[model samples]
Target: MRLLIADDHALILDMLQNFLEQEKDMEIVAANDMQDAISAVSAQPGFDLALLDYDMPGMDKLDGLRRFMENNSAPPVVILSGHAARDVAQRAVSMGARGFLPKSMPAQSLLHAIRFMALGEKYVPVDFLFSSDQADASPAPDGPSATALTARELDVLKALCDGKTNKEIARDLGLREPTIKLHVKTLYRRLGASNRTQAVMIARSWGIY
Candidate 1:
């Protein structure tokens, strides 16, 4: 498969390129930032897949999807991030990315996720599949206050905790993106989370997710 990888880190770029080169059927097109990735995708043709870093200098987050969409190339983009929160993963998938893989995942798992995504499959972290009952088994200190979110809000927050974007959260919950965005703002205020990562960290610490 013809593959492109965009990451700001040289070591990661080189390592991934070298590793994928050993596969014999893959070709590497490299980019160090979101802009470079976008340019590479636009200039080059017939890329079977792309691996994008969410925190690349130019992209910094979910912005790469806007550029990808603007370029009109949907080559099964996979978001690879160092701080792969549930909200980011969900958001990447929602923004039309083919898959989401954490940078911390094992190399084999990353490869497996990429290969599976290439075939139009979805992947979720095993840790995220647990039921809320299990997740919230620890009793809330003040009962409702500790678990204050309404069921829908909690659902939205869980998706956020999973690194899902507002659009993705909307899709997953069958709500409008605007509505999800509202929920997210409310969640941020309620949880004192300034960003998705912070919200997730706070929730985990509070045993809310």
Candidate 2:
């Protein structure tokens, strides 16, 4: 995959470029800011994916995103930020972004999200899509707040809601089947459930589904 990574922070740029290029099929072109990213696209014009720092210089929030997406030659884009609120992520998708991702996401998840969104599938963070109701995992007085779940656990729970098998979820999230089993176990413990059906039931009752 050819990637264009744009961030004002040189450290972030280096970090992403170094990590992504470790994949033999991946190549990266780094840019410091929005304008630089636009210029890079003009020069190469064929990046398989572009991950843009949502608050980087010249982004002007979503305006820069709008401009970038309007470009006919632009590759698929996903917004990455230290603080992307639910509304903003929703709005970015409404404005044609493939997804909104958090910078703090585990590197492996980010890689999976990068590939998932690049394939023209939307990859919004599960929490972002449900935060209005579960920001604190707020639920009935007797139940665990879905908020008690980690983002990755929420991801696993959501996959369960979709009725996907452990292997399928593992493949979707770029994790091993054993790691997925571990996540399922963690989800069961966190949600106080013993099986996938009960887990999904509890999650849905809490508005996590």
Candidate 3:
């Protein structure tokens, strides 16, 4: 398989390069940032897959993933994110990423994800895909439900999921901090979360991000 790997950290880039190089059938192209990744992919066509980082400096994950798909729709994309949340993983999958793996996972797991995603199968932690409903016998939904938040609230929630502070979110969405706070308060009440971290976790389960 010919793969394009994009990440910002030099150490990680080297580690991945070394590890994947061991696979005699795999040819790897590496890039340090979003722009470099874009150029590399464009310059080297017919890549079988792309292993992308969700949070890279100046790289918009969704946008970059879309661009990559626009060019190469046959080969699936797999996302590697340091941020661990079901919602982010779901979002990446919804956006055409065949697999989503957290950086905290072992290298073997990463290899497994790559192998599975190359086959056009979904890869997510099993726990994230199943929920127990012991009392009702009905299986819980795949993740948290987004029905609790309004359209605007969802926009707010999405910004929050990206690790943006309230002030930063307000500026990005062209709203006042007070307005953002009001929405946050309402979101917390709806999700039954008392803090930003909790809210993010719940929202992630619901795939709101």
Candidate 4:
């Protein structure tokens, strides 16, 4: 996969480049700021995905993300930030970001989220999506039910709420990774969710733990 990564921090850029390069099929294109990112996109089109730092230069707030999307609408763009604020993530999603990834995420999870976004899926950290503030403010729907989900599916949903990945869930439940994926697909269909983040929100609204 061809990726365009824009971050002002040289150290971060180096770290990401080194780690992502370990993926045999991945190619890393680095940019120092939003302007650099735009120029890179122009010079090298057809990037599979773009990971933009939330606070990069020339991008006050989400302007960089907007500009990048306007320039290259084909590749999925993701916002990467150290801030874990729910509003920031929500805003990025609203501004057409395919994913919002916290800088604090584990390397494996970050890689997984990237791959997930490449598959035309939206991604947000499960904990960030269901933060304590949102949970407290969210009103429970009357007569809500989780009847749409089977027993195993409910178990998977709970694991998701706890921020477990497919591999981890498979290990914990003594099931194969493919089986867990099938359960996740079923959960998405039953909950009418487009991605894992949306499914978690729907599950929360229904008072499903």
Candidate 5:
């Protein structure tokens, strides 16, 4: 896989580059800031993925992600941050970021997340997605907010967003298929959505993905 990773911190760039390059068939290029990242994309032109630091120079919060998406026929973009809030991560996903990766996350998980996003799956850590400080998240949902949804319901919502079938979600969550069905029913009612697509759309609007 080809990747473009940009951050202002040299140590982070080195660490990521060195670690990721150790895997076979992985090619990585690094840039120091958002402008440099854009320039690198312009020069290279067809990276498979791009990891952008959330607060680097020229990254006026999510404006940089918006600009990057607008500027290039870009690959999937994931935000890399050390301390971005839950609401910020949710907004990033809402703005079309493939995922958000906390700097403190385990490197193995980071690799998995990168691959997951590269494969067209959306990603955000569960804790980050369901954090306590969600003041910036979308206005409270009409039917049920995150507070009203159980953790298992949240998992079902995310699986729906992933386009997983009830059986598939059941297997992944280690629940019986009938139990998964029950969760789906609850998710639909609580999300005020009548169908899977509608439920996913509502969830995305609430930053659930």
Candidate 6:
């Protein structure tokens, strides 16, 4: 398979390239940023897959993911990020990403995810989903204000505090992206806050983490 991998970090880019080189059947093309990734994909239309860094130059967060989806004919463009928040992975999948791989993933698991995505299957870390579920099942801490938010909303809020995008929160909670947006809206209204930062700050003040 011919893969196009883009990341601003040279060490990561080099490490991934060297690791994938062990696969005799895989041909790797490298890029430093989203712009270079787009140009590389444009130049090599036959690329089987593209792995993009979540926070790379020329695009922010999922913007690069959207740009690649719109510009490339390639199937299964995967996202690689240092922050592998469950919601982020889900959001990427919702936005036409084929997979989400954490930078901290074990090499064997990373290879497995890549190969799985190459075969047109979505790959999200099982541990992420499991942890999300566990969090949901855990008891809420004592706080009268906490009662205003549902368990799921609290999940969303915690993700927001972690700087997760809406799609990521939805993915973490196994809800639709639109549903996550609605939750955020309701959360803001309930908290009497204007935005994510305000909501997080208010929640923190209320002893709700």
Which of the numbered candidates is closest to the native, going by highest lDDT?
Answer: 5
Report the C-alpha lDDT of model 3 over 160-196, residue by residue, as the tens digit: 8899998998899887776677667657756778988
TM-score of each: 0.60, 0.67, 0.58, 0.67, 0.66, 0.62
- Expressed as tens digits, the lDDT of each residue in 21-53 for candidate 6 is 999999999999989998887777888889999
Q: Local distance difference test, per candidate?
A: 0.72, 0.80, 0.72, 0.80, 0.82, 0.78
The whole-model C-alpha lDDT of candidate 3 against the native structure comes to 0.72
Candidate 2 on 1-209: residue-level lDDT in tens? 89889999889889988999899989999999999988888888898878889989989999999888877779988888887667778788888888888888889878777776665566675544554553443333344667556577789899999999999998999987767776786577557799999998998887757
Q: Please state the error at residue 190 of candidate 5 in Å.
A: 21
Look at candidate 2 and tell me the lDDT of residue 103: 82
**2 or 5, which is superior by TM-score?**
2
- Please provide, for model 4 over 1-209, each residue's C-alpha lDDT reduced to its tens digit, 9 standing for 90 to 100: 99999999999999999999999989999999999988888988889999999888887888767777888433788989886477778888988889899898889878877876776667776555554555332433333248534477789999998889999999998877866886687577557688989888887887766
* Model 1 accuracy (lDDT, Cα): 0.72
- Model 4 residue runs over 4 Å out of place are 72-74, 133-209
Q: For candidate 1, lDDT tens digit of each residue in 105-139?
A: 77875665566556554554433322243333333
CA displacement after TM-score superposition, residue 152 of candidate 5 (Å): 13
| Backbone clashes counted, model 2 | 2
User: How does model 4 score by TM-score?
Assistant: 0.67
Angstrom error at residue 197, model 3: 42
Q: What is the lDDT of residue 68 in candidate 2?
A: 88
